[model samples]
Target: MRAWRFHEPGNIANLVLEEVDTPPLNIGEALVRLECAALNPADRYLVQGQYPRAGAPPFTPGRDGAGTVVEVGPDSRFTPGDKVCLLGGGLTGVSLPGTLAEYAPLPEAWLAPIPDAWTFEQAATTLTSLTAWRALEICGGLQSNDTVLVTGASGGVGVAAVFLAKALGARIVALSRSAEKRKNLIALGADAAIDTESSTLEKEVRAAAGDQPISLVIENLGGPYLEKSVRMVAPEGRIMVIGLLADLTATVTIGLLIHKNIRIQGMSVNNFKAKEAQDAWTKIVDLYNANHHRPPISQVFPFAQVQEAFAHLQAGPMGKVLVRCSA
Candidate 1:
């Protein structure tokens, strides 16, 4: 088998294609022949040794993908030729050999059957949507009619958050730096789109929400947004932190917690309860089937051009970038 491997994690340049033996299937695991792999910011962070959850070096790098099951171990529900997509902790390429290769062994529990309406490229994006589902349903405790604010609303998780929140009947206020990208947010069902680069972000949000204070804040950027989120949330409101694209460090007003009874939480897609994961997976598929959610695909690179795909991911495209792993 041919797969991309990192001898030692330092930078993207360390990634190289090499011939390797097929990974043996463990109990409750299945061997998947990958058709499409999604490149995420975590992949870049893992290669740079910046992600906290990634494992030691000498592993393949990819978090999510869709493929056909080539073989299934004992006690697994999957069968040969079953179409599935992956979820869970082994998603980090540094810890386990992921979908960046032609084939990889994935836990049977982490694999979900792809919906009929979705292509492999579309199924490759399921993990991000699942993360959004967990953040809103479990971490943020979002309710219908609640006013929700999403930072970095143009990115993959951000866009998914906007769509999922809207489908749940929440009033969404989306924040993005680009005016053009804000249009994408509005199209994704955000009631109001605020330009984050604008000096009057706080005022704009206040005006958008009117009498309603923000009940939930879905923050994908950590730095400045984290600090501002503390001030904007309503009494007893929840703030879910999911990404760290901006600055990792945040300075928050401690008084806000005491005065408003706010709750701030950090969410990792890798850490999800079995029932919660199943519910989220079902919801996302239902939403997709209803035409309520559409995961954007900005670029598709061939497997041989893996380096170019990583470079493009670092360049910060508005939508998901994918690698077609098989012929």
Candidate 2:
């Protein structure tokens, strides 16, 4: 098998595609022949040694993909030729070799059957949606009448949160730095798309929410948005911090927390337990079945151009970029 490997993890462009032996399957694991894989910003950061959860050098870097099960070890529910795809990230590409390879030995618990309505591309492009499901729906307990706010709304997880929250009957507001991307956010079901860099962001959000309060917030970073979120969030609302695209630390007003009873939490897709991860994956499939809006595809590069794929990912695409691993 040929896999992309990094020896020192300094630059994504330094990744080398080399022939390597297939990983051996363990109990409750399946060896999947990957058809396609999705590329996230984290993948490049992992290869570049910027991600906190990245494994040591000499490992493949990928989190989500869809493939066919070529074999299964003992005690696994899947058999030969079962269609499976990955959602969350923890062991894959971190402690274990990731799905970027042609074949990956993955725990059956982290793999879910691809929905019948989705193609291999659709299934592979769903990592951010699964992240949003965990962040917005499960962690935040989003309700139909709730007004949801998603910071960095043009990014993968933020875009998915807007769409998923809307599909679940919540009115959503999308915040992005790009004026053009904000237009796309409105089409994705956000009640309003506001510029994250705007001076009067809180006032704009208040207008968007109308009578309802901002009951749930999916904050993308700890920078400028953190202080504003504390002020805009309604009493007893939940704020789930899922991304730190900016600085690692931000100042917050403790008074707001004590007065409004705002609950703030930080989470990652990799942190969910088995049962909750499976449930999130199941709900994502159902949600896609209804609207089939796979995150927009910016490009799909073949395996040989793996270096180019990372470049595209770093260029800040408007949507998902992918790698076709097999013929």
Candidate 3:
């Protein structure tokens, strides 16, 4: 099988397509004939060797994929030809060969049934949506009527956060650098959209919330925004930090945090265990099937053009970029 492997991660150029032997399914695992693979920021980080996961060189770089079961171990519950999407396996682009190939071995526990309403492209993007859902619903303890702010609101995770927050009946304020993207956010059920580039995001959020401080902040960008996030959070509000796309090194004022009684947390999609991850994936699938929301597909790439798909994600987009792996 052909897979995109990192020869010695330094840049995107290090990702090379090579033919390798297909991995066999182990006990409790199944071999999936991948239909689509979703590219995440972590994929780029792994390819560039920026992530903390240690691995030998020439690893395939993808975390989430949707596919059909081609073979299953005798111990697994799934049979051949079941449509599924994989969750946490720690095999994408870092610790092991990932979904960047035509096939991948996934644990049965990590597989979620794709909703009948969703296409392979949508299912491939479910992991990020599940992460965002867990961040706001489970970890953040979001409640209906609470005002939530989502940073990086045009990106994959950000868009998911917006939709999930809305689905849970929370009032959402989406922050983005682009005006056009802000318009899209409003269409996605955001109460309001703030332009983080031109206006003071802290001020805009305060104005939108209107005497009510932001109840929860789903943050992806750090740097200056962190300081502002700390300030704008309501007393007893929770701030979930998921990604650092802006600046990682920034001085924060501890006094504000002390006075505001804010709870700031770092959230990663990989932090959840098997049972929790499986539950979250099921909830997302149910939501999609119920017509509550859907994952947005910004673009779809052929399996042969996985590199181009990664490049498109790096350029930034309104939703997840998908790479179709099945003929």
lDDT of 3 by residue, 83-180 (tens): 98878434554586688899988777778887777777788886678779878988999899789999888899999899888888899988988888
**Pairs in clash, predicted candidate 2:** none
**Candidate 1 displacement at residue 257 in angstroms:** 2.6
List clashing residue pairs in candidate 3. 61-93
Candidate 1 global CA lDDT score = 0.83
lDDT of 2 by residue, 1-327 (tens): 988888887767768998999988888789999999888877877877887767777888888889999998777788888898886554787667887899998878888888886777778876788788888777888889899999878777877788889889999988887778888888878889998888888999998888998989999866867888999999999999987776668889999999999999997887777777778777876776778666666678999988888777655555677899996
Provide the clash count, candidate 3.
1
Model 1, span 1-327: residue lDDT tens: 889888787888888888899989878789999999998888877777877767666778888899999998777798899998876434436477788899988877778898776788988886678888889987777789799999888877888888888888899999988788788778878999998768888888888988887999999889988988888788998999998888878888898888899889988887876556767788778876786456888789999998998888666666678999997
Q: RMSD of each candidate?
A: 1.8, 2.1, 1.6
By TM-score, the best candidate is 3
TM-score, per-candidate, Cα-based: 0.94, 0.91, 0.95
Off by over 4 Å in 2: 50-53
Clashing residue pairs in all predictions, respectively, total: 0, 0, 1
Worst 10 residues of 3 by lDDT: 88-97
Q: Could you tell me the lDDT of residue 169 within candidate 2?
A: 94
Local lDDT at 248 for model 3? 66
Query: By the lDDT metric, which is better: model 1 or model 3?
Result: 1
